[model samples]
Each structure stands twice: as structure tokens, then as C-alpha cells.
Target: MKQGLIILGVLILGLSSCRKDPEDPLHKTPSSYKPTLVDPATIFPVGKFGMPQLPSDNPFTEEGIYLGRMLFYDPILSFDSSISCGSCHKQEYAFAEPKKFSTGIFGLQTGRNSSSLYNLAYSRKFFWDARQSTLREQVFEPIQAHNEMAMTLPFLAKRLARTDRYIEYFDKAFGSNPNVFDMSKALEQFLMTLVSKDSRFNGFFPGKFSLLSDTEKRGALLFNGLVDFDMVTGLATGTDCFHCHGGALAQQNNPDMGGIANNGLDGNFTDKGYGAITGNPADRGLFKTPSLLNIAVTGPYMHDGRFATLDEVIDHYSDNVNYLSPTISPMMAAHGNKQLKLTPQQKADLKAFLLTMTDSAFLTNPAYSNPFKK
Candidate 1:
């Protein structure tokens, strides 16, 4: 009986050793498959945004990004085959819709406004509430959301298998058949490549005050200066907009460093923003602070999309802050929680400064455009 058991164990070991990974030619991946490698330097502006932490398991390839792009623009990813990721996230509006709530499959509306997609490689947390930590994992939520694409993994896998383009791309990009794991990696590669560096603000950053117009220069002062109100007229001497939305990226990267906070929007816990994710009372009303890079186009601001225009947004910070909010950020509570109370001219100057952050090149980049549209 011992001899028979030993023989069975050896047989099992032999079979297991012979099995190949999905990358192997024996596992349906063609031996001829050789995806074109993409240099990380070309995709990332390391000097500007710094070299982002990349996924070691998935390297960038031309075929992989191309496949991911197709997946992004393809309506077939949805349950009813009615919408694509690009539907809500239009490039013209900096990948954010102008609406308060994004329309999903079956005309269902999303609870939160669609976030602008750029410099995503710099963001540590995904979504307004900071629920997800990775782009690959984050992609699944929208696809599976009942109001969104509403796609089942099994159904999506089978659907991809049936498509000729997906089959060819899958083999060329990942050296495997259609699968969700590789699909996400490909999407990650494509998403990581989206870099927004060409903007008036980017060009004249650091201490190049000579490059900015007079109005913009004054606005820059208000933005970066500390919050100080004038003794007379009650106007703010400085608005101090840089605490959260600071640095060249115009946004804080670390959650502890103001990447996530309650901006004194409300005193009540109606939404419970980040608190819903952590189940912590202290975190209630706190939300992720987005980069101000494309703020000009990416409005209906805030997580719930309460403010419609940039004017409204400025008004909130200038006068409408709810300092009494239970989970308000300490930064906001600093200086006795005084409102900015910027004058109309100061508000216009600040708005002028914000408009400079818009990257027109990023909005019209053909590389990030729809593959099917062309």
C-alpha cells in the first residue's frame, strides 16, 4: 500500500510540473507573439511628476496599451452594449462629464460626479471616497456596478473570446487568450501612460512670475500665500489655496498630507464620504482632493457634484465653509476657521490662475482618443 501511494504521488508531481503558465506557447499563446516594448521614460515625465511606482508584474507594451484603449472605448464592455467608459468621461471636458451625475447603462445615474482622469499615475487613492488603492482593481467596480456598465466577469470573458479583435490583441499583447487578469494589466499600462505636462501653469511653475500675466501673477500670490485678512474692508490679504492643492501637480499625494480631507462642505454626515469606506466616524465627510490641473473643464465640483460652476466653488471656500462640521479637516479649522472673504477682483484673479492650469494638449491628445472614432 505504501509503494502504491508513492507511485501516485510521483505521477501527480510529474503532471503538475508539465503544466505551463498562460504565457507559455503550450497554453494556447503563440510562439510568434512578441509585443513591442514601450520605454517608461517616454510615458512618464520623471523630472516633473517623478517616476511613479509601477506594477512590476505588468510592463508597458504597444500592443497592450492599444488593446486597453480599445477596451476603454468599446461599448461591448457594457451589459446592454449601450455605453463605454468614454461615454461618461469625455476628453473635451478633461475626462469628466459636465453633468452633476454621470449617466450609466439603462439611463441610470451615478451617485457621484465622474472624476477627471489624468495624472492618475500620481494618485495613491482612487475614487472620491478613497475606496480603491489601484487602477486595475478600480476598473472592476464601474464595470460591475448595477448603474454602470453592469458586466459580469464570466459574460465579459466569453464576449471577449467571441470578438476577433480581442482574440488577436490578447495574443499579441499578453500572449494569452481573453482573460480579465491580463485585461486589467493592459488597462493599467494604458492608464499609466496618460501624462499631462503641457499647460501654461506647468511652463511657468516654480518662480517664473515674469511669465504670467499681471492678473495671473496676483492670483498666484493669493493661491500660494498664507491666509491673512485685511484689518479694513474685511477682504483677505491672502487666500492660501496651496495647503491641499499644492506642488507642481497642484494636488497633495499623501492622504495624511491633505490628499483626503473634509473641506468644511457640510456639518452633517449625509454622504459620509471616506467614513463609509473606513467605517470611522472621524473620517466622515472627508473626500479625496483632486489635482487642480484640469479644474476649468472638470466641474460640477465636489464628490456629490453640489456646485455647478467654478464661481460657486470659489464662493464656498470664500464664504460658505461650514467650520462647525464634525469631521472638518484640521487645516480648515486652523486660524479659527475664518472664511477667505475674497473680494470680486480677488476671486477673478484666483479664477484666472486656475484657468492657466488647463492642459489643452492633454485634452486633444490623439493617443488618448478613441481608437474606434478614427
Candidate 2:
């Protein structure tokens, strides 16, 4: 009986020894975490662009990203090597040009304002007019634009090949291939990594910021569609601001839908927004609805950068453009065929809510800084 009891006790001990402990791996040293480390659950917060679906050809890698970073801040991509992608797309202003318009080669200002670079990972098409289909294709546009960089691909390749520093970088980034000399691909890789997901909105919400205040929360609720969007007036009752700019990124159209608008720019006379690209009249003034992630940062709002302040912009929308021609979007028909008449307090609250979307971490990330500097 004693021998049987001892064997039973030994069996129980063996079973306990074989069991795995949940925290055993905690003692092991971690090698390193990635620069782009992100929590999957919180990938897309309100007003934040979601993860990008990358093309198979231009797969993302740390080495490739590093190479691209060097190319982005390097002015060598330009005709005179005095300008670069970062020249107009300054980091401080959310990668937007400080001046109302951007000056390219020979001090010539481009027709449109330089758009801010954020939530780009979620973009399907690029540019104010949505001319380019892919970021890769878009990178070359400014380089070849007459008023912009004005440098051809062959010339850029020759220029890059001339420098020993570039030759070494090209070899390390791309495997023994001449294609690495094409700065566009490298720039695309770098730009793709320019993600800004660490904002007050991205991080802790109502809990983290006690200062967010009740008014701001109410303003947000209104901005989103707790209030109904008045189709007739284009003014949202109960603060239906989300109808035009609504989504995870507060964009009209996301990866799921497109937010191209014809918002009464002209009635019958038109800018022909998306239609210019497709040659379809229906697409007139149907410009890509930009993400409102950093709306406060990138202003002189709208495609033309006409309105300098949020107050002016609010006024434009609140007071419908009935005087403009007939090509206006149906949304403009909401507010009794007029614009919104938000009170002064409402406008302030809306602005406060918009400021919540700014992501400071992205604005000051050392990884995205000029690589030429130590």
C-alpha cells in the first residue's frame, strides 16, 4: 500500500512538471522591435488612415525603407540638386508647404498648394486632381514637371550613378540592379513608411485627455452623424458634418468608397474633377475627398487652397454657392439650397474637434528625418 501511494504521488509530480508556464518566456531577452511597430487592434482610429495595401512589386522592407528615406530628403533627385521631395513637403507643417503655394525649380510656384503627406497609406489615387494612379507613378510627376524638378529619368540616373555614396546605397537597397538608380521607387518606399498614427485620437481617447472637455465630445458627436445630414440644405442638423467627411479617416470615400465631390464649385460651368481623367462629364468637379486626419495642419483648405482659415471655410460651406454655375454636388442641396449657418460657438467647437486628430509622434519621428544628417 505504501509503495502504491508513493507511485501515485510521483505520477502527480510528473504531471505538474510537464505543464507549461505562461510567463516562462518573459525571462528571455528580446532582440529588437520594428520601427513600424503597431498594435493591430488600434490600427485605424477615428480620422486615422488604415494600413495600406502595398503592391506586390514594391514590397516593403526595412533595408528598402532605409534606402528610400535617404532618397526622400536628398535634393539630388532634382535638376539642380537644390530641391527635394522634402523641400515643399516640410515635416513641421505635417509635410505641407508653409507658403500658400510651393516653389519648384528656378523659384517658380506651382499652380496648386503642396498637399500634406499623412494618411497616404490609405490613398488609392494621389494629387489634387487625382491624376496619378499609384504613388510610384506620382513620384516622377514633380521631377519631370516643367515648373517643378524638370529632371528626366535618364539624367537623374546618370546623376545618381556619378556619386560613390549613391552607388553604394543603390547596391545595398536593390540587389545588383540598375533599377535602383530610379529615385522614384526609392522615394515611394520611403514615403509609404511616412505613417502618423500616434495622435490624441489615435492613442487614449476620452480617458487620456481630461481637457478634451464635454463641449469637444459633443462637437465630435455632432461632426459625426449623431445629427442627420440634411440632403436638401447640405447643412447637417444635429451636426451631421460626417456625411461629407466621414470614415475611420474622416474621408468621404475610403478603401471601400470614394468621396469625390462636385460641391457647387460651379453649377453648369465646371472644373470637371474626376471627369477630366476619365473624359466623363459626370465626373465634373468630382475631386478626391481629402482625409481630415490633419485638416488643421494642412490649410488654406480645399483643392485650390482658397480659404486661409477654418472660419472662412466653414462660411463657404454654411452659405451655399448658389451663385456658382450648375455643376455643384448634390450635397450642396441640403441646407435649403444654401450653406450652413453655424453659430460662433459651434464653429469653435468644430475646430477644437479637428485639432484632436493631429499626431505629434509622426510630425517629429527621427526615422523620417533627413538621413544626410548624422
Question: Considering every candidate listed, which one attains the maximal lDDT?
Answer: 1
TM-score, prediction 2 = 0.78
Total clashing pairs in model 1: 0
Worst 10 residues of 1 by lDDT: 22-31
TM-score against native, each model? 0.93, 0.78
Count residue pairs with overlapping backbones in model 2.
23
User: Tens digit of lDDT per residue, candidate 1, span 242-306?
Assistant: 98999889999799878999999988878998999999999999999999998999999999889
Please, what are the lDDT tens digits per residue for candidate 2 over residues 178-269? 24334556677778777777666655443454657776765676676444555896445555567667755566654224467666655653
Regions of model 1 farther than 4 Å from truth: 1-26
